[model samples]
Target: MEYSTKETSEKYSNITSLWRANSSSSSVIDAETSPVHVGPQNSLKENDKIEKLFGQPEGVDFKQYSGYVTVDPIAGRALFYYFVESPQDSASKPLVLWLNGGPGCSSLGGGAFGELGPFRVNKDGTLHSNQFSWISEANIIFLESPAGVGFSYTNTSSDYNFSGDSTTARDSYTFLVNWLERFPEYKASDFYLTGESYAGHYVPQLAQLILVHNNHPKKTIISTINLKGLAIGNAYVDFESNMKGTTEYYWSHALISDELYNKIISTCNFSTPSSASKKCNAYLDQIDEEIGNIFLYNIYAPLCNNRSLSSTSISEVDPCLPSYIQSYFNVPEVQKAMHANVTNLPYPWESCNSTLNLSWKDRPLTVLPLLHQLMKSGLRIWLYSGDMDVVVPVTDTRYAIKKLKLPVKTAWHPWYLQGEVGGYVEEYENLTLLTIRGAGHFVPTYQPNRALAFFSHFLSGKLLPKE
Candidate 1:
């Protein structure tokens, strides 16, 4: 019997659920007790306004907007989005579309609130300004893509039951078309697709769609979306390399025993796991025992043991912060302020949609071909990895990129920011591979200041400064 990708993922979902399913509270406050108003339903363009924020965040200069763009009216499927203008320049900055990957995660929650967004969620379910928000250099848009993820949803229940890569990419492309129509002022904006994790698939696929539409605008009912480039961090580009690299990463880092590592590495290839010998599965099981209860995403980063606020590191955002994010989005006032969960969602918001089971039907194992096409078309392509991320470690990314066999344009060198070495960089014909030193899976959250410097330079077309 052939199992679907969703079925395959289901088998492993529980193992990966620790970080994702931190806390999902149905903490919606009684709206009757606390008035949360979004004024009238007859607002202007969906993309041009924010209903309101729960409370004003101090020192925040950029305007904020959040709402939904209807992708298919007949299906009643809409995508939720949060837009923030550049803090200083409203009119001149390029627009960046940011995505986060679970294959089914909320970009608004992860990217906008957790990583490089202007605001961070406080434990008290309040908002605070992130000094290093990516909006400093560009107009940023965070999308909760494909109905059933975050606030994006469909009236047709089957929409949630059936969704894949093609559905996702097609819907995202449609969302952009409708969004551009609503926010026409940004029609000619220099747009770039940015994301991390599975968005390695999302960015390239969406970029490909936009590129095709730009060439045949008349075919698309909407005008051309000016897609210029793409940047993805710790991206999932190749399946075999990622799986192989992650196992090796654990062994090399002393998380697994030498005997077990040797046995598994020699016997097991994830590419054909079903055909594995009995010894391979036996060793793999032993490897899992060695990896028990540790934070696999960032090998060096400490986990929040004791679950206390005091255990948090002041330098990086708290590991328990995703719980804060989930709780904040649960607040009735906050949801109303952002015009989210308007129909009163039956379930609380989560960082990753466990409710979704895309099974890999729409997923492409490798987006390398798309990346190659984009690079040849002269689009600036960047693949950055946080060196500390074991989940999608830099080793796998390096291996994946090396397969391109593109001649290097610049030798690998240290890139500096704030008078210190920030990371390392190597440039190819049209592609740049960068590594954020000491950063984890979520690079922006772990290294905010350095991440800002990295992104600001990328957006400005400045090469990473060799120090």
Candidate 2:
């Protein structure tokens, strides 16, 4: 999620590194508590059930893909999406669900653009080829979760105002069930729930929910869960870590003066900080002017900075900022692939370009509780952060993990990719936290090669090398 004039909430690499913490945090073994109850898997019966619940795709095309749709059978009127990359043969592969967070943002931005989708954007705002895509390495699915996000519309356009983390998780889980019927091969594949930003909550809760249901006699049954792991870049897992990390990252980078840093640290008790909505609002207000004057999202834009583009210069294109959103969304190929009619929408796909008309009033911290439930059920959980993002910094993710209170399984260590330092890693009970170097909120867009290497390590159920 990107920030704009409006009020709302804003705010990954693949198989290269398997990081191990320096110290042991806790044990990964646990007893099952809650039981997952998924009824029969009669394909015909399930398909009929979902169709009855959610209508067929509006103008969206699934010809290239094979999957079923589950309408807002539970929510007011939100569509649930589940895509599959089935095995060429009958063998089963791991199933991974990808989510991008914007409170009101669509997964298509992150899930499709930054991570597993097969394409990327060029500096000129044109779509380009992505050769190191994650989906190529594993079976990946992207979702337009909750209602009113992406193509997933609702009867309540007002539903935009009704969002919270818990509601999102619950709705997401419901979508998972109906989605499973659409592609049953994944029902037994090692399941891994993953996402970024607010997804800090989405991935954990969804995983825990699956664990709970699996423990039940009638609910769904999952294999080892391969629970294998998950990775987050600049995740907002913990509020304290998030805020403090933001100031810290800026301060360390010399963006803030020592005096100002001291004042911020002394004034803000990250452990139990007050709402900086007013103060943060003021600060952003100042930054807003600068952002416009510079015609850049961050303080620095090499592409925008250079009068001429050199072959060696970083593509002047900054993929993560909101300013390029309109042009990015308007790409003919993108519109065609997403089944989006860019002209008809009232707002931009990115929240940064415009005020946030959508409401995060519905979001709640539901994933923490769900994480506890999963840990009790012997599920493996992992959380990661990309160090460069301010929206959902590493600090926030650290804070979120602290809340877990699980014993430390491994101590902090640097995770490396191809022998180069990638990020830091920590282990606790069944959970792991990782940080990717030089990657922002959208890890793939920033470092696709690293993302690919990371996912490669993860799917193999191995720990990345520590260098």
Candidate 3:
């Protein structure tokens, strides 16, 4: 349910006031306090450089860097990032900032290690090269945002209570500004924002902030981000669309009975789910029971059979990868190598922080308006979904896009990859919507080749093969 009401707005203001008042004393250099023009410096960049990860495979050619970028010095807040340069022609590749959204997930664990980064962690905690890593197409930075996620943290313990969409966007924007200072060579490189799941909120919000900064009257080059576009996979864009699409999808896919579907439709209000009647809640509970123990992220994919072992196939999805990632990052040696956990956070590293997720204060009913603003600014926007995912199903995304009321530039058609149908695509005037046929919520994990195909197309600004 969305917390967009006047009461919620007042709560948000109170929280923000408290945060600012508490943080007013600290003297830290962040995006807000940094100089307007930043120059390339070899020192800080060199310090953050990962000479090698603990279990990284040998013969690695690309440079990797991981460290914390302070966003709020007053709160001692910082965000951790893992950056991998393209193995070849690193200087020429565009910089892609990837975020993974749980509102509280670790992008380092989800994006960098589990999905599109250069390496995948093994059951034994060793790293192996991912043949279809997106690093081949762009310099990727996987950020663990909002201070409470992954190794990112704030000195002020109470800051966790105030975490929400606005703070995340602001901190992330600050991260980019400070990160650019640390790696100024990429100041002129084209930048793109990419994320999946809840980053539906993160990617667009951050992009909007960058655009605002770029247009500021007294903005300097350093403060002016070179944001070009963004793409989100299986994104949670609108609550109403998502709710309707989910129930409809479950019914259409035969995951629920016709009677239950009708009950939900008639009893529940998608737009105001927080006010759902007890009968509606009971019906929702029944629907969940009917769906059973299957993995909702990918209904057809098997549950983690061997949580102790990691799959080595590039073409196959590993359901247990998250467990393996958790194991790998918690290793003291790994943390030392990546320059993470410097403050020795009391909690063990988790892929998604349930506490923080539960504490999320303000989520809009829809981000379609922010997206429209970005499109008006002429940024390339693409929304792709994995047909197998029930969490943010293809149907829901389609419903959300329909709400935009955009003029269709291209009708739906099958797009091919390697002589096979990869998925279908439809081009609107300012946005593109596509799907990965057999992939799940984490598209890259389930269909790496197809994901890479579309990612490369996006970076190159080329149309998908219509064969």
Candidate 4:
């Protein structure tokens, strides 16, 4: 679910509880704290710190992998990603980078747990198998982006609250370059960048930057970005589309009054300025502000409401579910696998570091600016929504996509998973629009089968499955 500035701050305040649950007790830290690490002028130093911080493991565990991936040029942060690795190497197998957008979120949480990660944590704290794991079709990499997220930490206390799309895009680009140096083989594999929520901004911005670099006269031409395409579930792009989607969905679901709907529509046409006016913007703003407290919560209630034994109970108190998952990652065995000492860090695996909270910033309405840059360059892009997501709202995504004005290839139609009508899909010259049925903001964790099928088709460069 999309977090308001207030709720976002509150969420940040309580994130440490899960950290203690996951990390070694010695590493427990307050969310608002930061550490100043000195020296270490090279990647080797960074690597050594990682080893010293987490320690060695007992036996080979399936949930861990060892590697030093960089988020910047000079400094490298450590990462341990979990997925079912392919038995044999094939260049044809695609490598996908998954992102979860919070200006401060860990991809390991959203991309790994919410979307394509291979396992789900049960209510009993045991791992459960995921039938629709995306790794079955592609090699998925989850990064704790920016810095100071998940296992990715930075020395510069200055980097601590730094945020905005430009810095994130640049840092992600740096990661790809340095990560390629660390694991040289996968550089040219068919690559796709996918994420949800704020990733609507993060994915496109990063993809555009990657496309620019690839088109340059560089020796390593990233052949076939397979970039083939990108898709987001319950995306937040256009302000109007998102807000309207919320009200309309509420109306259709009988969550609001037709009289109130008419009042909203007749009063607020958020599409154009000449149409929107200062008065309209004010009214719309008022509606949007109140949404999070009332209707929006109801729409997203099912996500947290499912206290069923069949699903993973990350926790009801922490709005950030990944904190609980971080506790799971703090195991003695997991720490050893990553070569961490466990004694150095003040906390266990953190879904978020309060020090990083200063880095989080609320996104402005600039998707159209980015989308226009993408379309003008002839890149394939897709912006989608989850019908039930009151947070980002389908209306906002629709409004955002409309701004591109690309030539239409296919009109709106249902995109299905298995035999069911999972969501709707639309096609433009170099873009696709999809909507997931019954999904909230975190689509994959809420609806894994549909999410995987969507990515399967995207990575394969084919038309979506028939409903």
Residue 128 lDDT in model 1?
Answer: 75
- By lDDT, the best candidate is 3
lDDT of 3 by residue, 1-467 (tens): 11111122122111112122211211111224334323344587788999899899889999999988888776788889999999999899999999998778888888898888999888778988999999999999999988888899999999988798877888888889889888888989999999997888888888877877787767656546788899999988777777788778889999999999999889887665556677877777686568766776777988776443457877766667777788989999999999989988998887777667667776666788888878899899999998988777898899999999999989999999889999999999989999999998888888989999999998777669999
Candidate closest to the true structure, highest TM-score: 3
The lDDT of model 2 is 0.52
Instruction: Give lDDT tens digits, candidate 4, residues 1-467.
Output: 23322244224211111111111111111111111122222454234232221322233223333344545434434343332343235445777777776556667655665456765544334454455667777767777666665666655556654555566666676666655544456767767777877677677777776766666554343332445456666665555455566666666766556766777778765443334556545544444343344424226543332452344442221233443465556667655645543335565565555545444543444466666666667555666566666556676677667666677788878866667798888888777887778766676666667777777777665668665
410: Cα error in model 3, Å? 0.7
In candidate 1, stretches whose alpha carbon ends up further than 4 angstroms from where it belongs are: 1-43, 46-48, 273-278, 305-307, 310-314, 358-360
Badly placed stretches (over 4 Å) of model 4 are 1-68, 72-84, 87-90, 218-228, 247-252, 258-323, 339-343, 347-364, 376-378
TM-score of each predicted structure versus truth? 0.88, 0.72, 0.91, 0.74
Better of 1 and 3 by TM-score: 3
The C-alpha RMSD in Å for every predicted model, in order, reads 8.4, 8.8, 6.9, 9.3
Once model 3 is optimally superposed onto the true structure by TM-score, how far is the C-alpha of residue 312 displaced, in angstroms? 1.2
- The residue-level lDDT of candidate 4 at 162 comes to 54
Ranking of all predicted structures according to TM-score, beginning with the best and ending with the worst: 3, 1, 4, 2
Off by over 4 Å in 3: 1-42, 306-309
